[model samples]
Target: MRPKEFVYHRARDLDHALALLAEHGEEARPISGGQSLVPMMNLRLARPDHLVDVNDLGLDEIREEAGALHVGAMVRHERYLTDPLIRRHLPALLEAVHWIGHPTIRRNGTLGGSLCHADPTAELPAMAVLHGARIVLASTAGRREVAACDFFKGAYMTDVQPGEMLVSVIFPCPQGAHSGAFEELGERLGDFAMGSFGVVLEHEGGVIRRAATVCGGAKMTPIRLPEIEAALQGQTLAGLDAAALGDRVTGLIAPAGDFQVSAEYRRALIGELAGRALQRARDIALNAQP
Candidate 1:
């Protein structure tokens, strides 16, 4: 199936894109990379009356401002694999990007597109939640920011209102040295994950100072594991029981099943992946110690 007939508008700038969206309202969709939207449109799952192209709007830079990294929404997935800032500051996100679709998809898929698509099993959204990232939205009225944890309302849903566009994402830089890891289980190398986990740990003198954990494919949106994080605080690396911590995740989430796997299977993946991710992150942090 093909998308319904639609008016195509090439936005010359940010204001032009906002105007097009404002005029068309919910009937318009702002497209950057179009990796996700195009497929949905082809399937007739999305039938926007207007296609506002934002490719030239220039939202594709990664910069640091006021202690946070400002990643333009149009930045392609492949960039994360090689970007020095991403590798140096967001290692977990870099690892997660490796699990995204194949080379062709990574070359064209935009960060903003993935977040807006809001697939519960995607890596970027889980990384965003784990890092406490901020999502920036712009429109004719003005610009506003939303927390990543709150930006995602559900699978394939977000807080982006009609006439608004996602401009960039603000990721707070890890302070005082930290190590992170991302783990997932998928049917195939490039397939959507059955379950995934991401963790960032800040430790000192063999003790955990801070921890952030987020799980994917276990909820409508990326679910942050505050319970596990709370348990990790002040825990010594040598004494930590990774398997026990993994078991705790099973009780915290209730994932829905699909044809590929049972709900119970997903729960098991979450528990197993959580432990592996947490232990790997801890090991990285400890190894970095002087």
Candidate 2:
């Protein structure tokens, strides 16, 4: 079915977009790539009375700011594959981007749209949580930054209020030598994942100094494993037990069953993916050592 009749307003600038949003309030929906929203609208899942087009608002640049990478909300997924800043600082995101839909989806899907859409199985949200990124939301009132972990309230929900638009995301640069890996299992190449895992390891002298892990497609939102990260601290790469860590993850997460798979199957799949991601991350860190 086609979307309900709505007024379309093409925003000329950032302020214009905010004003449009403020004027329409909850009745307005700001659209950029429209990869996620348009489908929802087509299915009548969303029926905003006004559509505020933000594609021309100039929120599509990627740059390094202070000690973090500042990625404009409208930056497309395709950029993640080629941007030097993303390559250097957020390689895991680059890796995960490869798993997103297909070439067409990657070419048009915007980072902000994906995060705001907040699919529990999406790779971008899981990457944001793994990187400890900050999401910037803007409105006529002002702007506020929310932690990535807290920004996602649930599937298809976020902290973004009715009158606000996501401006950009800020990811802190890794301080030392680091490596990351992303792994997932899906029914098909571009299908939504059955389970996915991402791991980032900051290491020195073959020992883990810092670690961050996140899982997707297994919970309400991307789940960050702080306890697992803490357990990895000071662990030497030579003695790390991937299977044991996988077992620990299996015990910690309780994934709900669905039509595609049973809860126990998903739990085991996530655990295996976590172990593979961790092992791959460790190997990459070791290879980078001088």
What are the lDDT scores of the predictions, listed in order? 0.92, 0.92
Candidate 1 overall lDDT versus native? 0.92
Candidate 1 lDDT, 227-257, residue by residue in tens:
9999999999877788899999999999999
Residue 43 miss distance in model 2 (angstroms):
0.6
Backbone clashes in candidate 2 total 0
Evaluated at residue 231, the lDDT of candidate 1 is 98
Residue 206 C-alpha lDDT in model 2: 90
Candidate 2 regions exceeding 4 Å error are: none
Model 1 compared with the native: what TM-score?
0.98
TM-score, candidate 2, is 0.98
Per-prediction TM-score to the true structure, in the order listed: 0.98, 0.98
List the pairs of residues colliding in candidate 1.
none
Worst 10 residues of 2 by lDDT: 171-180
> Please, what are the lDDT tens digits per residue for candidate 2 over residues 1-290?
99999999999999999999999999999999999999999999989999999999888889998989999999999988988889998878889999998899999999999999998899999999989999999999999999999999998999999899999999887768889899988899888888999988888889999999999976989999988999998999878888889889999999998889899999999999999988888888888888
